[model samples]
Target: MSELHNHADRVLSVVESSSAAALSRLAASWRRSLVRHGIDPATVQGPQRLTQRELNVLVESNDSFLRSATPRVDNLYALVGQSGCAVLLTDARGIVLQHRVNDGDAEVFSDWGLWSGGNWSEEAEGTNGIGTCLAERRRVTIHRDDHFIARNTGLSCMDAPIFGPNGQLLGALDVSSARSDQTEGFNQLISAMVEQTARQIETDFFRATFPKARIIVAGDDTREGSLLAVDQDDLVVGATRLARAALDLPTEGELRPIPAVDLLGRSEESPKGFEGAERAAVMRALSRADGNVSAAAKALGIGRATMYRRMKRLGISEKSH
Candidate 1:
């Protein structure tokens, strides 16, 4: 039997099996391709390409997203281009918006439909890198025969999903190579770079969405790029997808304006009552005045006697200030 027929048989057996619980990610994707997407594992057709008019419409609609992603994509290409890889940026639907390929490898990549305007959604192209990554909304490396389709078994693709500022699925960043010599280890390394670049693009897009808001690193976990956008009034205006998940905030729609201190759990650590507010104000004034009673009173717009009496009522020692 031919290799393509062998691959098709393998896919059919897995999809028809009842061991759903034991399926690996690749197996699950294969099942999805065969059952849900109705893609034939032995299919030899390339990806669907959009016309110039349709491509133009998509580009115009995603202008801001393209603007934010172009630089990062270029940087990633610079890092991996000489390795005979083609770098592609796709929309959330897995439509290729932009790609960078070396002159020597352009013909091969183009033939594989790794160019702009190619529709690579899992529903359209089976379980390839860009399609599977977007479908799963995570980082993935589809190496060689791991691909669901026999025709794509020659390629290795590393991809990471990019989320928008509002925690929406933006698209994916992909690095693909048809090099027969590319090993899984090298693909793993490129996967890390692809994930990192995708994250940088997410941060850039998030920051751009709230240009005037203060961007705060919300948590110590740097992998998700947990960030919050704070307004002048100290209200959280926006949060990245990981930040939302970490903080138990809504993952979509307009985030309710939450106090920065409350969200950060600082309010519980500090005072809460009206007297507590007064005490805090007094302490702040005193600190600003270098603990000078008269200066602090002047800063507070109160008489020195009143300031001293309030300090005593608040249980603040003169020496502690």
Candidate 2:
């Protein structure tokens, strides 16, 4: 007859009757929590937390990731901290590595185990924001009673998965609010911020991973951060997850050294005969010379008059540059 029992009964009914494919993502997560993880919806226990020593080891191993993510975590906190939200960054396994909360709200979040060292993996904490986002490898907003566990039903969590430069699952960025007044609309806005911040963290991590490589924005829409890292030889040394998915490139491990031009669909090898190749060569020389005809001809080891004749034949305008 209590609200907790009501919640448990609702979860049990959904898990028992609804097929996985027939349920919405949230309901499917509830089923996963109940069936796969064997979580009791009425359980009152908080999430498991690693000991200090274990947390230290995990932090040391993820040093670079935390370093790349910490600043963004602080920035996101600055944006949402006053709204009574706690910002947390978790590793791929949903172990919290960094946590930021205002002093006034720290105790509340800490009591709920939303602090560094807390493990919120789907296996440990069931259907919640950080856990579900990492489980699905996407953005998720678990608002209030949408949580699978009755104890967690009072919290609203927004999370986004962060992918590494190697296109591996890095972790998730989460913002959790314990405010009873939090609405679904506000959570939606916070979810957008979480996703954007996650993308920025990914970009920073990618750039740091290839400090000396030239970063190319490979797509028109930059929100996904579709980027390619090219070495001095113009070989693509790395790619973001979005870039890999868009270009049909391998998603993990060492990327094969593919030519950037080939990936961009601008290969210099011409199907059109020698004339096309010659034109391409002439264009390259002109580009390298910054549109100076004499310099381009000198670089090509040809007379200026010959260069002019070739440009005319190639139908390249000198003023086009």
Candidate 3:
């Protein structure tokens, strides 16, 4: 009632007479159109769930697969890595086999869980690349609204299925990025690249791994996880209930996956002293300060001279910023 009253006021107040025909007409019949094109609303994804045991199985299980497959997985990673896109390989059961991501993508891509042994299917994660590709054994474009998680509404993923040596359904391979609303040509190009990668994997699997030439393989492969959110420095910021329970972080702002020295430089003033959650925030703060002594000191609540001394000790410099 309040909304209708507001819309009616633009035409005239209740005090005004019916002499205003144009205003009356607009007020009487103005309605919003709610339709979409090209995309099928039924393209919604189905429910999916992956237990910690499953993820642990995937991580521990990859070495054998990698050993058998050899550099083909490496080549695929190199190919996808060429485009600066995140790539993942998943088994027929939707368990992630291999994940090759660029060093520069960890910040925006904190959610590597999408391909980390989680379920990928229309009925599982929604109309996603890995899931649909697994089901269709073909290529697909899973755009933003097509995601199950709200935070993932900004990503787009392309997926293709893979085959084993004896024509068995091996898994799916995928190329994913946050900015997929690119040109139609780009989408086509992504699909083509994914197909090529799948072929390369098949080629490698056959010539090197498989002894028989009679085997033919077919079709397809992510995004989003419940892992806790961490700052670049690896400090836990916010986490999903699932993440906290899975990783066992004591607090919301705690650290789970500790940042390595290469990614987050070791602290100088108190690298060993700053334990628990403090380390992630401190590293992130220093990085953002650009190694500026004055800036970092202020952020850390220490003196500028102290900051420089700390930087010298920590081995992190302005260049690291």
Candidate 4:
């Protein structure tokens, strides 16, 4: 504990003297955040959560994200529960939309202001994982003593941003532990796991939003990239952050109407040609229509006989309800 105090003192000195060059980039950034939020590192207090009514309004406004993130957050909690970690799903604004904490540790975490409907934005809480990740728009692990606030020195947190099908910031996935040892490097492992889970949530959101589009899982290692939503004409209609990054797709501006060949490294001449694309489109349409051949065919703007012929040629067996 004395060591944490010393580190905090050093950080305060750096912030006071504007000598952040001595600290690592991450630590220096935290000091900057402290300055930006007008938080005194030396005399920081615990965070204040929203009132019951305000929290309720915030939660209700984010109903869609809550529904999409609940299962993923629950599964993550189950995986990390043994480690005394709490998993949180927060909206883009850093309001905790969903959280999982073991019953035994509930009181301790609640005392730390780590609970559902709690606000952990960078402006509210000095430099923790969920808030900082949302502020920086990146994955980060703020380990013990790395937080700007001395009051939160006992906590360690890893967080990753989750993007929606439209490439908007949906929220963040966070894994936090009350006890973290910097030397143990447990937080590093936790960071990787949380990032993977965040990607999964993003991919699921993309698929849910574009069930009728050909969901292309493309990358050097396809599973690494978030799924991409391609239209019947081989246009990129939607992409996950991972997909955008992996395929070197546009990071900014609209992504739709972008050519699939440009992103997927394949064309009509390739063995996996337009034939595969058509097959994927047909299957997705059928799936979206719930195996109603007439509806699926109409959605594809084709007659029923043509649809069945294409499905047969593509070896796609359909129930044809």
Candidate 5:
């Protein structure tokens, strides 16, 4: 037999040799163990019938060039396959389109008895992010006990609602995982996975809408910052000198007025002052303000609200002078 085949056979043999009682006890132990890990019992949302329009659109998108370029967005379940989390994708109509459980996680998740075609509405799944985002059409993160199901209290999920060309509600994307890692901060891993999935979706959208364009306007993009695109909007639909000032892009300080689009393909292998500039902005502003936020706001050419919000977002805090 081929080496790969032999490997597979060995794995199968190991699995097959496992006793039936062992499996039963394992399943039983996992049921409550997952609960202790934060699987909200009440919010164990399953799948539901999708609307005709929603199904048609998703089916088309699933077969589009975007799918060819980036399969994970539509291959929602596959992305998180057996990683101890579940990835769900829904349509504009609150119908669940695709669902996938992380590898090795299927057994634990199946304990919640959440299957395909389950409805996750507050009326059904209650207050959970996936169902709630679909119901409210917003981005949300649902943690333990937030789910309607008391037994589902062990799961934490981060979800974001998607949009189409018309800014129409397209669907919801989410990552659901056991809350055991929350103490270790690896729960952030799930959030990062969701963000990557979102980025792929956005990238596909950009490629489809502007096939000939090289620039991308990924708003608040993660690679470096936001992306810039040059459409026929007449106005420069991208970052301004203020943004350049905030990020302290060294190239810009050198008199190069790089638009957001220019940075799309620019990888962060070089000394791109992302971290330094971010910290410098506060230091420079605070220095100018002598630690007075109101003064810093004026000097930074932003509103006080904007200044405070940035500070909070950046984890910067100081006593008001």
Candidate 6:
């Protein structure tokens, strides 16, 4: 216990003196968390979970988000399961909407309050990953003692902010390890991977939300992710962070929901009109359903008969492979 206190005090001293450290950016955030928010680093409390009724209401309200992000979150957990980490998706305000931990690491993660319905907001947990990422509005890694709260000093967290299609802050994705002694190199790698995974989730959400738009995947064709949504009028309606940055788009406050001509400096390829858009939507639904017409119709919220008629008019093949 004495050794733990010494380590915490040393971290605080570095932050207070503004001295350079391996985690200088995270240390700076911790300093602000303590000074600006008046959080007592030594006296920080544990996460406060919502009541069962409150949790149900919150989940119901964010039903769309849960549906869109759950699959990706599960994939992320599978990738990092061997490393004994917990993957979490939180709402904009830092409520844990969903989370996953390997069965072997479940007990350890639960002890650290890494379950659904727990609040990790800055106000609730000080300079932790989910809350701090939301506060900084950027990707960040809070490793172990870099956390403002002494109680959380055992956790190492890498988090990325998720943005909505129209450039609004939606939520955050976090990969947190209960192991404090992981090499800095490993943590950096985790941060990079987590950032990529978050971007993929954002892209998926954008595509699902704007099904009728001409979704263009920017960047290399060999690699997936990074997409822009173009409307039937050839206007750039939405873009992921990867797409916006790769395309040199104007700042978030400026270019969103604007024309592709304004930013891409070119008109969209000949849009096929409403028929083309509808056909594309149906095709996308079919693809999502693995070419099952019944499932595709259900996904598109249309009757099977109506879907068949639309498919016939749009010239979509009836053969489901």
lDDT of 2 by residue, 143-212 (tens): 8888888889889999999999999999999999999999999999999999999999999999999999
What are the clash counts of all predictions, listed in order?
0, 0, 16, 0, 33, 0
Q: Across residues 1-321, which tens digit of lDDT does each residue of candidate 4 receive?
A: 566577678777766564535456665566656767876665546676778888888889877666767788888888998778999898898888777888998998999888877888888877889888988899998887778777887888999998876677878899988965434377888899899888878777778877888886764646754677776555567777777777777764455455566666674232267787676577657755767888989999999999989888988777531
The C-alpha TM-scores of every prediction are 0.81, 0.82, 0.46, 0.76, 0.46, 0.75
Worst 10 residues of 3 by lDDT: 216-225
The TM-score, computed over Cα atoms with residue i paired to residue i, of candidate 5 is 0.46
Please give me the total number of clashing residue pairs in predicted model 2. Answer: 0
Residue 278 in model 5: lDDT: 56
Write down the worst ten-residue block by lDDT for model 6: 250-259
In candidate 3, position 21 carries an lDDT of 49
How do the residues 1-321 of candidate 6 rate in per-residue lDDT, one tens digit apiece?
A: 675677668757777674457356677677677777777777745679998899899999988877888888888888887888899999999999888988888888877888889999887788889999999889988888768778888889999999876567888999999885677789899899888888788777888888998898753432445677877545566776667667777536434345455456655574567877676577657655767899989999999999999888877786522
lDDT of 5 by residue, 1-321 (tens): 243344334323333455563264322222332333333332223534445675567667655433533476546555555456677665554455566765567677555533344455444454566666766655666666444344555678777766443234566677777746543255456666675666457545544654543444344434632333332211122332223334444323222223232344333222236654554455456654667888988988989998888888766677421
lDDT of each: 0.87, 0.87, 0.52, 0.76, 0.51, 0.78
Ranked by lDDT from best down, the candidates are 2, 1, 6, 4, 3, 5
Off by over 4 Å in 3: 1-53, 59-64, 68-70, 146-151, 212-321
Residue-level lDDT tens digits of model 3 in 1-321: 443334334323321445454343222221110011122222233224456686676667655455544465566567666566777778876666666777777555546355455565444443466766776666677665444333444567878777653345678877777655454467568777777667666555544442322221110100111232333444333333223344444423323333333222433122233543354455666655544557867978989887767666666565554
Flag clash pairs in model 1: none
Q: For model 1, how does the per-residue alpha-carbon lDDT over 1-321 read when each residue is reduced to its tens digit?
A: 399889888878877777863278888898889889899899888889999899999989999999999999999999999999999999999999999999999999999999999998999988999999999998999998888888888999999999998899989999999999999999999999999999899999999999998888775546557899876445577999989988888887767666567678653223467887777677656655766889989988999999889999998777654
